[model samples]
Target: MFAAAAIAIIITMVLALIRGFIGPTLYDRILAVNMFGTQTVLVIAILGFMMGRPDFLDIALVYALINFVGVIALLKYFKYGSLSIGPGEERNTEKSSHMDKS
Candidate 1:
């Protein structure tokens, strides 16, 4: 059963890579990459169990965290064109004088 699951995950990972390569929109590709990362974590865990090596789970956990941060950074970079800006910082380059009066 575990073998079957690992095979399924590998298949899905391949599909995700295809999507990441040919997705119509940028967001679609990003989402595909994120999905691929998540599937990788699952596959790692499964492989660790099958091999009776628990250390792989720790590596998987770290990879999962890095994947999460990477996706968020990608989104931020695409949205704001930079990652140096803080969350509450204004993204616009120009401030309107009319709005400043209020």
Candidate 2:
């Protein structure tokens, strides 16, 4: 049963990769990539169980965290054209307005 689950996850991962590559819109691609990351985590956990090494779950957890952060960064970067989200970072609206005058 566990082996079957792993295989299913792998198949879904492949489909997600395909969608990520060929999706029409940016949002579609982003969602596909996110799905792919999730499926990868599932596959990793299943593999660990099959191999009698549950320690891989820790690695999977780290990978999932990375995936979440990476997706957020990508969305923010694309939406704002910048990746800096620090508390002290301010938008240069004045600079943009000044440029518009010229």
Q: Which ten residues in a row have the lowest lDDT in candidate 1?
A: 92-101
What would the per-residue lDDT of candidate 1 be over residues 1-102, giving only the tens digit for each residue? Answer: 889999999999999999999999999899999999999999999999899997899999999999999999999999778898767566556576336645
Best by lDDT: 1
CA lDDT, candidate 2, residue 69 = 98
Compared with the true structure, model 2 gives a TM-score of 0.81
Instruction: Report lDDT (Cα) of residue 76, candidate 2.
Output: 84
- Per-residue CA lDDT of candidate 2, range 32-72, in tens? 98998899888889999999999999999999999999899
All candidates' lDDT scores? 0.90, 0.86
Clashes by residue pair, model 2: none
